[model samples]
Target: MEFIDFFILAFSAVFLFLWWRTCFTKTKPKNLPPGPPGWPLVGNLFQVFLQRRHFIFLIPDLRKKYGPMFTMQMGQRTLVIITSPQLIHEALIQKGSAFASRPPDSPIRLVFSVGKCAVNSAEYGPLWRTLRRNFVTELMSPLRIKQCSWIREWAMENHMKRLQIENFEQGCVDVMEICRFTVCSILVCICFGAKLPETWIKDIDGVTKEVMLMTSPQLPDFLPILTPLFCKQMKKAKELRKRQLECLVPLIKNRRAYVEKGENPDSSMVSPVGAAYVDSLFGLEVPGRGHLNEEELVTLCSELFVAGIDTSTSVLQWAFLELVLNQEIQEKLYEEILEIVGKNGLITEDTVEKMSYLNAVVKETLRVHSPAHFTLAHAATEETELGGYKIPTNVNVEFYIEWMTEDPSLWKDPDVFRPERFLDGDGVNVDLTGTKGALKMLPFGAGRRTCPGLALGVLHVNLMLARMVQAFKWVPKPNEIPDPTETFAFTVVMKNPLKAVILPR
Candidate 1:
């Protein structure tokens, strides 16, 4: 009722409005995808960060409220999540060049990737193109794949031996651990051209796992001021890097020495596989980039090592779990394998190709449990329109591969484990490449930046699965069926590691 009281109230209201505008309200120039509103200073940061494990679950609800294409603000960054296959096709395929470049890495990622020299995180330009081309031509080409067949056979045999030991000693084997060890051993052979002792294989595996856990997106990544508070993680990352370098440097040095001495690097391996991946790198001459230095070489090898082991292991783990759950499907696959390669006959790279049911099972596994829920985030090179929404240059975009593949409209009984979908009926002869038109499924991503390791990954999965099935009958342990509950590692992984009984057929 007094003049001073009225004046004080007005002042308070004006101050509150100014604070809200400055901290909470994000200015929009024109058209941006619709999303949930947030509190002052921290927009959707806590909401998304706290529920990252169930982040994919939130998308469907968000899509229902804000359409297929929507935006979310994480601190200062704007993330555009694309759920529809059509929109994904538009951005990643039709307008791929406009969206191919990766965004700048978070501080943690930069440290892990060794200044972003790794192929996956490298920016789109001469450097990226050069590195990618080298990877494809020297390491992942069809000829190279065939040349690496000996490595595959040796690795598969070693895997079987390890599995047999585990099954004998424990009666129930941890499929996830043995699978990871086998893949890591194979990767070490491919990368370094040697059959490392089990201890060294494990040492490398531990380093890779640490890096994956450390480089995973964290709150400090979104809010840099909090990075100091997360000093433990940063220190751990540095230590992992040091351990990684220690594991890899010797191999690189030895290969370099072999090259200098004019000796064949492949001679060091258990089986000669033409040139090892490291040997190829030694000879690679990237245009404008020249020869890769020691640190760069270590970083690239680390990328390949982790990418190869993690993705394949995750897929195979899911494959085995699916087989354990669906015994009939497993029977069908084993029968098909028997028909293709007689019981006593060896299953080689060529033999595995002829087995259609095996291929279908692997395809189905990828469709149902795509290892990566999201591709590494891509940034628009310039202003673009996706799904009729304006996307500004440098806006971070992620294609929802898992969501697209599992869309009810795209495939029947999408939730059910049905390899037969790829074999016959409505889903018959589906193309996984997305090159035919829109991608029905993209476990390895799609477009120019599609995983360079696609061929290698498929070969590894098929061979591992086929051999395991042929060698043993796998079943869930008593009261311990393999649970398919998913968790986020660098890849989508089993929260509960698969435990199964293996019996010699």
Candidate 2:
């Protein structure tokens, strides 16, 4: 038995080596981007595993050694990480269509993304367009968002009161937990078209987070050939997906019933009925795929919660941390808020636009601490050339967001947290939409695949920050400074969650 086991291991290793050499080396395309050479069979897969959670930290050193655009062979998967802003512009903006689609989802992702049916993971095509259009037109339109101001106001009031209560009772609030609930509360209303009880919302938040964490990149994600060995993990992922459906499918059914009756889903709230994402999907037909089934509806609605919650929560957490650390900046922002809207004025969506410094602060936060350190991997639709290198069809291209935002050549004093730069210097007339010219920074990404919720996301951050500043003075706890060291979750979050003292004005 021992001899047979050893023989099987040796044969498997030899087969993989020969397969790698035949497929990768012999059939390699000319002038693929330069990168660190890898071992015969495994390639850089071991290095990725070695770095573990800190793999993000290794990219900068690799960028310094290899040029801006480089490749890595992760078993059968080939990834090109692009750090040069010009090269990013060339690939994502200049030739956007060639790089519009997402790479194929892994097995775990297939369960969550429901076979690429969600907007974020769907391939670029008529199906993607139909879904994206339904989302933007029904939910994200300016009038629709404006109608939902009551939701934000409701969440903000509850959030501030909760924070005040917590600060009084426990002396410090858990910023991430409290802020996550508030963001989830707002998104829950938008996605389900109804307000749910706090406990119910919390349950939904927990399950969605579990799904997100489970779907993160794993060894089998990169090396599909080894998938059979990780049966337990795959099984766990399916269970989580089932749990997610259990939490979300009921909401989808409720919305469908409400739409069928032509009645408002949430009459208690003044926001327009039939504007919920689920409501819009009831009778909508994909060009080639006909009307979406219930599971697809649940998946798309789940995408809303998955996409908006963490990214917005992380930004709010980082913005407050920065405000707590930089007292002068905080004071300046408060003074501007007072001048524009008065001491006790509520920072509504309409009022938030009038505050230039407030907008600048959010922009600076996004630049310094982009919630997503890297854009979602984009796959090439066909063979293309970028930065004088050949990119073969279906290869994943990832842009390093932090590198571009912090590059010295792009912004003056790039490391400094100076919102004034946008008002006066190199960031002046900068376009967040990469359509104008060379890319400066992409917080929500660029081109056809750009986040449709870009405007809503910025508004959420700006409104939350302004109201927090107006209602209370944020300061670090006694002798400790707010630690801004980043750790990766679904989004880049503070390693040390911000714990601060909030004094009522």
| Best model number under lDDT | 2
**Alpha-carbon shift of residue 218 in model 1 (angstroms):** 1.0
Off by over 4 Å in 2: 1-26, 262-272
> In model 1, what is the error at residue 419, expressed in angstroms?
1.2
Clashes of 1: 0
Compute each candidate's TM-score over C-alphas. Answer: 0.92, 0.95
lDDT of each: 0.81, 0.85
Instruction: Score candidate 2 by lDDT.
Output: 0.85
| Residue 59 CA displacement from its true place in model 2, Å | 1.3
Positional deviation of 215 in candidate 2, in angstroms? 1.0
Name model 1 segments beyond 4 Å from true.
1-29, 50-53, 262-274, 287-289
